[model samples]
Target: MYTLAVCAEMVFRDLPIEERARRLHDAGFQVEIWDWTRHDLAALERTGAVFSSMTGYIRGSLTDEDDAAELLRTAEESVKAAALLGCPRLNLHGTGLDGRGLPVDPVAGEATGPMWIAAHRTLGRVAELGESAGVVFTLENLNTAVDHPGVPFAKAADTLALVAAVNRPGLKMNLDLYHAQIGEGNLIELVRRAHGLGLIGEIQVADVPGRCEPGTGEIAYPAVARALADLGYDGTVAMEAWASGDDDLALDRFRTAFTV
Candidate 1:
């Protein structure tokens, strides 16, 4: 089944978290929580949304054994928490390239060699832990630093490389279109590559220039959506957009784009 998820950061800011989740469920969307700190698994159980792991706030990359162990513990807990909420996947961001929030040079930045190595090592442990907990761990590419300041792995190639390095079944790509539009020029080509590598697990979308609803921006969303459909991608095609101070208007725009 093709699934829909609303990034929690966009929808749950003003409302109670549970209420946000309930609304998503009512609107026919499965919820994907982002950078969420307040709600727990018990709360997720009450609401129908699936919980994906939020990263970047946790620490550095998942590549170091010691650091990986710590993340394993956290992932284990998140898995248990998500299980309570009946979620099947936990998503993460790669490590930050620089502490100063500069765009990472793909070839030389800390997030490149050692950091990438560390992420592989870290996620290897995460994969083992996640298997036992029944949670699938996925890593997503953020928009280039100009958009996701201080984050690492902005391009699709970097995320795919990290997944290949780990070579673990649990690790895969989150593949958000908003980020892809900013950094990648060819969506279909990249998606095809990810499929060939078995790296894509989840997908999301928003338009650029303002990260607003699909129809309101310049992205070729219809083509992108068609590409996703052609791939037989049945996972969540979440709308990761900002609300225009009017929740109904934002959701209406989302519904229109997705109704197909």
Candidate 2:
């Protein structure tokens, strides 16, 4: 069975981060978060929620040499925080994103040849760090069309290419279906290809039109869930979505969508 988790940062807006995590825990879901640097790790640990993943870098970009150094340094720090939270996976992007989900230094379009080479080199070092720290680092896909514009390698195909090229167990792709829908539709095949290549680390979901829980928008999530089950993907299927109305109801809808 797929282990269902929820991003605490997206739901239960009325509560504190720890409280949000606790609520998810009590509701029978694992928790996910972003930017561990901004949160009180100890307080979150006290909530007794099982953390599935969190943002893996504080400040770094894979675009240049100096930025890559910063990325590796902060990634090392992030590993420590992940250990404290007992989180098994850490999430990364092509560049460091600001609080608003915009890349700090956004790229205009597709990556150049040199940029691709640098990203591959930088991710090799990141894999070594993850290997040493006993955690997996996942590069998540983003939809430049909506939430994250100007972020290079924001497509699932690009992310899969990078992870598959590196071909290390320590590194894998965070196959986010919500972004894939906007950036590239045909999600069932996307999941098939990514998992078929043994490159996926996690799967995140939210509805299109609105970044809310399943059933509120166009995605036939139950079909996606059936596809996952058919593929024997027993990994995490997470709700990285906001509450359409009531938080608990949204969670229920998410659970229903993936309960194949």
Candidate 3:
């Protein structure tokens, strides 16, 4: 079976981090965060909620040779923070080309083949660092069409390929269903393919169109949840979506839809 974890940053925007963790824990859910740098680790521990994962590093481009050192440095710091918060996994985004936040090649105006090579080498080193720290690194696929425009690893296939090229035990994929649905329609197939290859280490969910609770959009989250369970996926399925109504109701819908 799969457990549900809510993205505290997105769902509980107004509340303090400690209160957010408390409420989610009280409601029998785990919590995930974008960053653990500012949160009270002790208070979160007291809530008895699992810190599923946190973003590994932001702002640095994994595909840029010049930014490789900085990226690795930030990732090292993230591993330490994850250890402190009792989180075993870290999520990373392919920031931009050349660490300049330009998204695409400034001259070619699109992603080039050489970028992938640099990304593979840089991520391999970061994963090596994570392996010694007992932390796993997940490269998350974002939707360049909407949520994350210009992100290099927006496609599920590309992210999967990157992880495969790295071929590190500490490296894996953070498959976000919402982004996958937007960027590519074959959600279940992608999940099955990635799981079969043992590339998927973490999962996140949000319905398409509105990016809200499962039932609030076009994607059938219940079927997706069942597919995950059937595939023997035991990782946390984080609700990384916006709330449409009562937070409790939104979470209730998520729990009911993914109870398998």
Candidate 4:
């Protein structure tokens, strides 16, 4: 069966982390946290909710030298935090071009060859640390056109190439389908390619036009879910969308759509 992990940070923002964990556990879903530092580890543990994945300690440009160094350090700290929380995966993003540590317009001076090389070097080091800590690091792709304008690594192919270049056993791709749909429309093809290469570490979903529940958008999530199942993707498929109405109802639709 496909495992589902809900982004508590987005879905249950009003509730305490502990309460979110308990509610998710009761609702039969795993939890994905964006920032582990904001949560109470002990409280999360008490609920016994499985932590599907979390954002990396540092969320900035891996292309810049100074930021890359800080990213490595943050990764080491994140490894310790993951161990403490019993989480196995950490997700990362390529902040922007030139390491300004913020999302930059992709149109304004795209990432160059040197930036790619720097990313490989930085991620390679982080992957090494993750390997020893029993944690895997996943580089995620964001949509630069709308939600995350100017961020680098917005394409699945480019991010996967980075993972391949890093060539670390602990580093893989976190394919967020919503962003992929906006940035690149060929979702199924990308998923197939990533799965065939064993590059996909995790998957997150929403729909286009609005980052809301699946059925409310144009993306056919049921088909996507079935495709993933056909590819034998056993990793967590996280629900990282906004709910328009009843939260529980939104979750029910998510489960129904993806439960292959």
Top candidate by TM-score: 2
Residue pair clashes in candidate 1: 53-91, 62-122, 63-118, 63-119, 63-122
Each model's lDDT: 0.68, 0.95, 0.82, 0.82
Name the candidate, 3 or 4, with the larger TM-score value. 4
Point out the worst 10-residue segment of candidate 4 by lDDT.
Answer: 96-105
CA deviation > 4 Å runs, candidate 3: 96-109
User: Please, what are the lDDT tens digits per residue for candidate 2 over residues 167-236?
Assistant: 9989999999999999999999999999899898999999998999999999999999999999999899
TM-score of each: 0.85, 0.99, 0.92, 0.94
How far does residue 144 in candidate 1 sit from its true spot (Å)?
A: 3.2
Clash totals for all models, in order? Answer: 5, 0, 0, 2
Candidate 1 lDDT (Cα, whole model)?
0.68
**C-alpha RMSD of candidate 3:** 2.9
Off by over 4 Å in 1: 50-57, 63-66, 96-110
Question: What's the distance in Å from true for residue 203, model 1?
Answer: 0.5
